[model samples]
Target: MKILNIYRSEPDATTKKLVEIVTRDRESVEFDLNVDAPDYDKLVDEIFAADKTICWW
Candidate 1:
């Protein structure tokens, strides 16, 4: 299973620590951009193109 965590932080020590705690057991992780739109059709199409998408607001 893949986990996607989105946080609203401008890179900080605390954020790092929290991320470490949450992903400590994970052996691998990949970072990617999260795109959103007011147009549901476009947004869904983009999501379908990706393997998985987790949006945070």
Candidate 2:
């Protein structure tokens, strides 16, 4: 099964780690901003950008 990596907090920092995993698997990586602010599309775009989509928070 494919794994979708999502960082519930500090997406920018987690993005770096996502890159490493993507490089190894040659898969797509997504990013979402979660900090009490409300932005649904922003969140969706992040998940859709990746091959596998998931929510950790």
Q: Tens digits of per-residue lDDT for model 2 on 14-41?
A: 6666556565755644444455765768
All models, RMSD in angstroms:
5.9, 4.8
Local distance difference test, per candidate?
0.48, 0.57
What is candidate 1's TM-score against the reference? 0.39
* Model 1 Cα lDDT, one tens digit per residue, 1-57: 344444333436876676667567653243333334245565556555555454333
Model 1, backbone clash pairs (residues 3+ apart or across chains), number: 0
Judge candidate 1 at residue 18 and give its lDDT: 65
